[model samples]
Target chain A: MTCKEVTRLISESLDRELPFYQRLSLHAHFHLCIFCKRYARQLLFIRETLRSLSQRIEDPVFSLPPLSEEARESMKRRIREQVLPPDQGNLEQ
Target chain B: MNRKQPIDQHQTSHPEVWVDQHGDYLFRYALLRLQNAELAQDLVQDTFLAALRARHSFTGQSSERTWLVGILKHKIIDYLRRSWRECPVDEIDSSLNSIEEFFDKTGHLRDISHGWTADPGTILEQREFQGILERCLAELPFRTATAFSLREMDGLPAEEICKILGISSGNLHVLLYRARTHLRHCLEIHWFVKIRKD
Candidate 1:
């Protein structure tokens, strides 16, 4: 297979599960082609970086700047108004 | 007053009371994923309303936070569906795009730099680099960004992302490949390139 083809298989390889083959041919190629090997490593690095970045987004901490208190109160107000009947919500207010 | 809630995803009927408990967390989650403050806030608001409307179906098997997140995921999916653009994602013939851009026609490394050789750990630790990365991600097309984030960042499987983003597994892989390629290039230009010049 071409080096370009090997690079695509390299990406497919990183998923680490659901076993996509062509791994043999892909590896055979990188043995001969240092450039494509480096490219494969770089692809893995980028995938690692993106995964690391997502850790923050996935379990996002509350410390990140939030809506202002006024906005929060306003949103609560809007939600309350939507979920509750006007008279009942107003009476509680 | 800010005691951490235990990690039980059991459902609760008091989603109305959840604003004080989960609002900011939800907003932060959406903000990190979507990168739009107003949209995130709106999503938090909308998610609450949706839970209230659908409270009947929420079996209390999961924790309140888990249940709310379930609703929130639906909102995110709906947003992705509504916002996805057509062919710029799929129809551009990216088959040759990577080969031409990164590798020479003879498949040798050309002018393109696999040159971002900085420590990935150190680079991730840099807050400014992270900010730059987020901005670069925001620059990606809507569906491309969503598919990439859901898979790489959020640690989702390809099949699930395909279902959520409404695309085939093949399309999902293509988008992910392109997203990684674009992000690597963008990070190099913004982060490594700047570091090298400095």
Candidate 2:
């Protein structure tokens, strides 16, 4: 396979999303091509790095502070007013 | 002062029930995609508000959670498009320096088949790697970034992403291709050139 083909398949290969024949072709190319091998390694590294980074940032303390009770109530009130018309002011039916 | 009622219990068949239940999760999901808490919160709120207005269109084929997420995904794309139009394309640092330096200086790549061990301790301590990945994501074109974030971060299926983005599967693949290629190149430059210099 050409470098362009290898490049296009790198992400799919890393994700294991490519079809069997495509995977075999990529494996064949990588086995013979040092550049493609390095490229595959780099792609793998990128995937690994992103996966780890996502895990680290997965649970950041909600950078914005929690909505205050007043703010929450105000938002609820606004939503209620918008959804419930004047005649249906009492949302509970 | 009157006690505040729970948002979920609010009686109208409004979509707020969905938000009340899933808002925080949606916010977290959007924050991961947008990397801006305020924007994430707004996106979640907009998702619910829009869903409420168009509640009729929901056919109930999928779970409500999935439907809301689908809506939120579109909101994210719209937000990205608006923001992209507002801002000029500028070069941002997209280096793989930290990972490269660690590999070159310490040769850890040989020891670990995966550059990162699955251990939580090692992963959390790699702050530079996290920063680089975030920077790399930011460098992606707006649509490509949205598609990758939806697929990778949100774990949405390709078909769902196509429906939400109103793009063909071929278009979706193209966007995903661009996103992944840009990320790979960014990582390579970070490792090969940036880290070697350091």
lDDT of 2 by residue, A1-93 (tens): 556556667655543388888888888986876666765665555555445544444355223234344534544665676676632434343
* C-alpha TM-score for every candidate: 0.74, 0.57
Query: What is the CAPRI rating of model 1's predicted complex?
Result: acceptable
Query: Which candidate's lDDT is highest?
Result: 1
Note the DockQ of each predicted structure.
0.35, 0.24
Q: Tens-digit lDDT track for model 1 on B1-198? A: 124332222445444468778887787778777878888888888888888767657777787788888788778767866776443655334332443586667765453555567676557777787788777887776666777778776778777877776778777776777776676667766776678777
Q: What is the alpha-carbon interface RMSD for each candidate? A: 6.7, 8.0
Return the number of clashes found in candidate 2. Answer: 3
RMSD of 1: 6.0
* TM match of model 2 to true structure: 0.57
Task: Give the per-residue lDDT digits (tens) of candidate 1, residues A14-61.
Answer: 554424357667777878877677767777787787666545543332
The fraction of reference interface contacts (C-alpha pairs within 8 A across chains A and B) present in each candidate is: 0.37, 0.08
The superposed Cα distance between candidate 1 and the true structure at residue B51, in angstroms, equals 2.2
lDDT of 2 by residue, B38-150 (tens): 67777777777777666657776787777887888788877765664564434111322222332334322222222322343353355565566667777775666777877
